[model samples]
Target: MDGHRIRVGTASWTDPSLIQCKRFYPPGCTSAEGRLRYYADKFPLVEVDSSYYALPSARNAHAWVERTPDDFAFNLKAFRLFTGHQTPAKALPKDVQQALAGHFAVKKNLYYKDTPAEIRDLLWHRFENAVRPLREAGKLRALHFQFAPWVTRSARAQDHILECQRRLAGYHLAVEFRHRSWFEGDAAGDTLAFERAHDLTHVVVDEPQGFENSIPTVWAVTSPKLAILRLHGRNAATWNIGGEAASDRFNYDYSDAELGALVAPLRETASLAGETHAIFNNNYGDQGQRNAATLQALLDGA
Candidate 1:
């Protein structure tokens, strides 16, 4: 199944309870194990994102491997190490801070806005360790080290991905770029070249918000044998207008017709380009699941 994969999937890493369904669902999703079963029975690949926030116990991971089938795969997003600012700097050693300061000077705490060396080290350990059960089960697809728009095209960013390869040597890696600077078009060729050289997957996103780019688009540069699509739904108006746009979180949804149009292009693109894994991300409500079903139907030519 190396090159023949054209997977249409979903991005509900947790469940209704954790995201928007909390109000309507009331009780909450049973457990991670249960949610895995629920989605695995539906989508072929899932984009697990909680690991980007907290490391999971291997025990929990083992259950994930056991629950899903072979045709299915879980593409995980790298945690604080890749998203460095998520780690708390004050909690790190002075030596770690000093070393990181050499690269990131004038840093405050590591958790929210600063990316320190200490945080990177900690994230490396957890990221490498997180692959155990998935590898054992042969269910791990690739690790997505997505960066924010704030991460300008610095030598450090390239070096960070290089260093991360050392930590994630055996597992597959995917990188999602969120900055407009990445699209100097030909200028970003080195980044894509690096990914190809290492067999790393590049994330392609469909978002409609935030800082204007000559291309306001973020995520949509796929080249690896494997592709991950996050259809963050075209809620462009709400995302740009004052009230809802001012909200803290992402708000997106896909309509039946929109999902209908998405599959053929995706499948056709992957068939011509390479292998692809597309996941629906209208996690606004119980809509993720419904939209997922819609995409699956379109893929099946239903």
Candidate 2:
């Protein structure tokens, strides 16, 4: 295999369909702890997708450390609201929701700009504190900042990312751009340069193309520390469909052909970075698991 570390795994292990798939986990691995233990046994790395919907608690991170081996790694998605996305008020902790009493009359979904400066500061504090357990345990790979589709390329947007980098200092942060503007023209080079300047990992995504939100599959390494490849299977029809759960949108199964196409690019990117993570986010059933394993095998042979 390559000298650089190449970790392959799925975005999440606890998807509803994945749990019901019953193929990845052994019999009687019904408990959350048990399932995680089993998954950690199979994959060296995993992305915590649930963190995107709800705030992650240090208590759960500690439990994860206890269940997994010393070498296991976790890449967590940042909370939706923290990344300029619309977050449901219900998703916030009860106490946090209460703290936003003044804004309660506004709307159910709130964006980053809508929150008070004090609340936003507290949010940054809470999120950093919550991931402290993983950081101390040496299990955290990176805090993935996957921005909203409307977060287009602009001076203000770039400044926000810089602000995020400053706020989350010392923690590895990977930025996955959703809007095509960030990658479509001269913006691509500028984006890469900015990431390198700030040491932010540029998340190389494999997703459906031609959509307004789609970022083309531009394989490149912006960080010397790590590079991430998230495979969001090419199901264009549902990629932009509204009112659907994340699992439904990324439901397409990856073919061997699709996985094969990524081999050379991944290898090239891995050669430039200290570690490269190839995470499957197709996550409908056991498809992500199977595809991750397949990619691992391919990389092993590379």
Q: List model 1 lDDT by residue over 1-302, tens digit each.
A: 66746777766556443354553233545676666776688778887766765665577677778888877788877765465534544434466656667544554445433554556567567557756788778777777787755666678877777777787777777877767676566746766676767666766677774544222332333454577676666666554454422222345657777777676667765764456777766566656666777777777773
What tens-digit string does per-residue lDDT give for candidate 2 at 160-269? Answer: 88888788888999999999999888989999998898899999888899977999888888888899999999999989777746788898888888888889988889
Off by over 4 Å in 2: 1-3
Tell me the whole-model lDDT of each prediction, alpha carbons only.
0.64, 0.89
Steric clash pairs (candidate 2): none
> Which is the leading candidate under lDDT?
2
Q: How many steric overlaps are in each model, in order?
A: 6, 0
Candidate 1: residue pairs that collide: 85-111, 87-110, 87-111, 88-111, 89-110, 205-219
Per-model TM-score versus the true fold: 0.78, 0.97
Model 1, residue 82: C-alpha shift (Å): 2.2
Model 1 residue 189 distance off true place after TM-score fit, in angstroms: 4.2
